[model samples]
Target chain A: MNRYIKLVNFEISRFIKLYFVLIAITVISQVTGTIMISSQYVNSASEAIYQHGVSIEQFITERGLMSMFQVTASLWFLGPIALCIAALIFYTFFIWYRDWFAKNTFIYRLLMLPTARINIYLAKATSIFLLVLGLVALQLFLIPLLSTILKWIVPVDLRLDMSVTELIDSFFYLQIILPQSFVEFLIYYGIGFMVVFIVFTAILFERSFRLKGILLGGVYGILSIAIFTMPFFIFIDYLYPIELLAVETVLGLIVAAMSIWVSHYLLTKKVMV
Target chain B: MIEIKEITKKFGRKKVLNGVSFTAEKGEITCIIGVNGVGKTTILNAIMNLTPVNSGQILINGEKIHKGSYENVTFIPDAMTMLPQMTISQAMEFMQDFYNTWNQKRASEILGFFKLKESDRISELSKGNKAKVNLLLGLAMDVDFILMDEPFSGIDIFSREQIAEVFTSHLIEDRGVIITTHEIGDIEHLIDKVVLLDQGVVLKEFNSEEMRETEGKSVVDVMREVFKA
Candidate 1:
């Protein structure tokens, strides 16, 4: 357990420099975006009421109140979020590959760590998991700051004051990230965790077998996806909606368990440095 | 003892190791000598479980090798295992973090012996210094068996001599050492046993002293005769 945490910490340390850079990008891009969009909304509102001979009521009805939903919709806001997501996805594979491809091949040290090889696999996955959650937490914390930015740019009557929940509800992506209910959060992140494990196992397959392993890993990954979605296709006619969800959940768990077992086998018996 | 019981390893269809077997006992130096592509490094990797074998078993002290075996057995590959960006001190700290067998005092001692500063990044070191650091990391571990893959392969004469001097130094301290090298002229006097391999097979395994005493042959002379035959 202790070794696993240290391994995770070690992995985190390797990526921390880039991680902080990612955070900085997210902050700068999103805040700049919010201010820009909010300023545009307020300027248009002023122009319409003051110059175009429309009442504030007409301006409100025509342009709508400046809200975080509108502010969050801009490319400035979504682009950074997309970039963060893409970066995390790229890192999911790079985390494992970096050790093997490093100047001196740190895989040898990691594999020869005198602990169960599964600890290394788990620690890597855990590091990715922690980093992903860390970014998500950052986004959640950034929402209010975004709201504050919108407030600072637009006049009070021209903007809508939203609670954190209302802002999240207004944004479809935010709902997916920090789901409204605990169960929904579990279901969303649970499938995410399983897919990450499957992808990690696939990478190990490539590392172990090289060219032939790529085919093997691809087939393994496709099979996992097929199994997870099987209930929607095969049992849709017979199972209730709740029953189908339960089936999907069970299959997701099974896939996760299989990936871990295969990963453990590969790490211990088949992994190549 | 670190015993390899007839291990076979295949890279795709090509057999890199064809049922090769050997043993290295504690307090002795076993040298595996072969030309390049003869599976010398593969054999060492198998012993350390750096790569898996298609068949047979590896045992350290009469137990089947596993992750725990690393505490007692360590491998120093032909290249450094630490990241190039890491300083020597950070690499040592990394070892200390992962291995209970890490000896910081001995690590410091070997660093000083190599005349290397701890603050030097591995990437900045010359090939000879890098090889010394590679060997230093393994030797500093209080392991019973150390497997080195060609510690003298690309080193300068002075570096080779310094590394050869290590075989006779107290820093070795009775650990069983299995080193693979294509050239043995420089350290012929230091090896206790030699396992001569050709094309994935062990051509000969003998005590170096016995070869000199009984056959009146140096390690290289035996290699020439065996390969010629």
Candidate 2:
């Protein structure tokens, strides 16, 4: 456990130190966008409702503005996807250049380290997870700052009675706000992302084969999803009264889990260089 | 002590290793000499559990080493290219954190012996110095068996001599070492047993003294005749 902690800490610290400038740029963009949008909403609230024939209170309640703020504060799903892309691009270039520079270095040497392979995998995954989470936290911090700034510009009547502490509490809850039915869905999504990379890396390790593993894994992943859901789709046409969202969510989770599990098994057991 | 029993590895139709077997006793150096594509490095990979074998098993100190038992082994390959962005000290710190058997004091001594400064980034070091660092890390591990695949392939003569001394004086004591290399002149005096391989088969297994006395030939000469090189 101590070794695992040290390994994860090492990875996280290295990533933050190496990419602080990029992270700072992302945060600055997010903060600027959040402040601009919130100020616009505050300024146009009265006009939007009375002149535009839109009931502000009803629209806000129905659309769940509070929940939307929380979700947007966490950068929604798009934030994680963006972060993943950035990480993938950075690591891809970094790994490629490093391997090219040191042609004779084998992956077997890394496997010989006196720690569990699973721990190494987990450390890297955790670094990605925490980096995304840290960016979300930064976005959340800007909400209160934006709110305070808007209050000075606009009258007090237009501003909602939301405090930074309240906003933080809501944001914290939003972090785990998924329903029990969707919990597995989110978990599987995260695992599926991890597996895609694991398979890609395993293939790379096999012979330093370029992008074949990733490409193959992607094809396999899509095939697996199709195979898993095609039967359900066929059956669902007959059982027209079924709860489609619930059934789809459950099936998606199962398929994602199976794909990730298979990917990891193949990576650990069959990978060679 | 390390023992490899009847190991076979096949990639589809091509047999990389075919029912090969050997053993290394404690406090002795076992050298594996083979032509290119003869599975010398494959054997090391199999023993280290870096690659799975199609058949047979590997044991260290009479205990089986396999997928679930990977922690009991250590291996140093021919050449390593670490993250070029890392300094020597940073890499050492990473090794110290990851390996339970890492000896910081010995690692420091070796760094000093090689005249490698802590602040030097891996990219700044020459290929020979990089190879020396790889050797030093392998030696610093308190493992029962150290498997090195072509340890001196890209190193300079002076660094090779320094590494050879480190291997003879401090690395091989109450622990088994298996080195695969073509450069026999640097390590011939240190090796106790020699295993000759050709095309995935063991052609000969002889003790160093026995080969010298009976054949009146050095290991290099024997290899030259065996491979017809």
Candidate 3:
């Protein structure tokens, strides 16, 4: 377990340096956009309440309602997309440089370590999970900060008409509900993808004499995806009842289990030094 | 403490090891001398269970070695086969974390002996230094047997001499060192037994004193005469 942790720590330390740059960019863009948009909302709210003689409570409710949908809808798209791209890049870095890293003196040194191979695999998985989780958390924070800044910048009269608590409540609810579910879903998805990728590469490496492993892995991965998705595609037309969440969950679990088992078998038996 | 019996391996249709049989006693250096492509490395790998032999029984300390018995053996392949990406320290740390037999003090001493910097990545080192580090790690492991495939192939003459001395001084007293190499001149004095291989078979096996007295020549000279014959 300690060995696994060390491996995880090593991976995270290395990755954070690369990922922080992207985070910085995200922070700047989100903060700027929030400030700009909030100012507009404030002006619009003030004009509607004071100039048009609209009731303060109704104006506040209206603006809060609008902000709820707008903020959530934007985050619903941006958060997951940003996280997925970052996660892909992180995992891809490992795939791309595996051979170079695998054959290095460092790995030779590492191979001699008294740790189990499973620990190494788990370490990588944990690092990837943490990275994805961190990105999601950052995005979640951004949504609220954006909402607050927008409320502050809006005209004073408009601010009086709106219920800041109600506006924040909606944002928080969407932030928790969507991002939490999305992160969980992606965790499973990412692990499945990683298992398949690792196994394919390991098998290809064992079969070939050169660096053809990556190419063969890509080909194998595509074939596996096709095979795995065939059942879903075939049954797609009859999937209208929508309450078969239990069935869907069970099937997903089975597929993930099978993929993991296959990867474990290939990695243990087929991989060569 | 290691035994190989009737082992044969093939790459495609080309037979590499053909019914090769040998035993390596504890606390001795066994040199498997052969021409290139004669299954020297294959035999070592087979003993380590790194490669599957088509037909054979490899027993380490009376237990058969397979995928499960990997913990009992440590393999030091040719210098070229060493992982090139790890820094000396990172490699040591990894080894320390994995193997029960990892001796950090011994490894540290060896690292200090070679003056290997902690931050110097393996790929950044010269070929000889890389070999030195490889040998250092193999020697530090507290295993029953150490199988080295061409440990000195690409190393320099001076470094080879230093490595030979290190092998003799540190290795020969307590553990088995099985080495396969074409260059037997430098290691001639260090080896206690010689297993001469030709075309995938063990042609001869003789101890150092017996071979010297009977043949009136060193292992290198005997190799030349045997292969010539």
lDDT winner: 1
**For all the models shown, what interface RMSD does each have?**
0.9, 3.1, 4.5
Ranking by DockQ: 1, 2, 3
Over the true interface, candidate 1 deviates by an RMSD, in Å, of 0.9
DockQ winner, 1 or 2: 1
Q: Highest TM-score: which candidate? A: 1
DockQ, structure candidate 3? 0.26
Q: By the DockQ metric, which is better: model 1 or model 3? A: 1
Q: Candidate 3 residues B168-217, lDDT tens each?
A: 67653588878898767767878889999988988888897788888688
Query: Could you report the DockQ of all the candidates, in the order they appear?
Result: 0.86, 0.37, 0.26
lDDT of each: 0.89, 0.66, 0.66
Q: What clash count goes with each model?
A: 0, 0, 19
Q: TM per model? A: 0.97, 0.74, 0.74
Q: Give the distance in Å from residue B94's predicted Cα in candidate 3 to where it truly belongs.
A: 2.9
What is the number of residue pairs that collide in model 2? 0
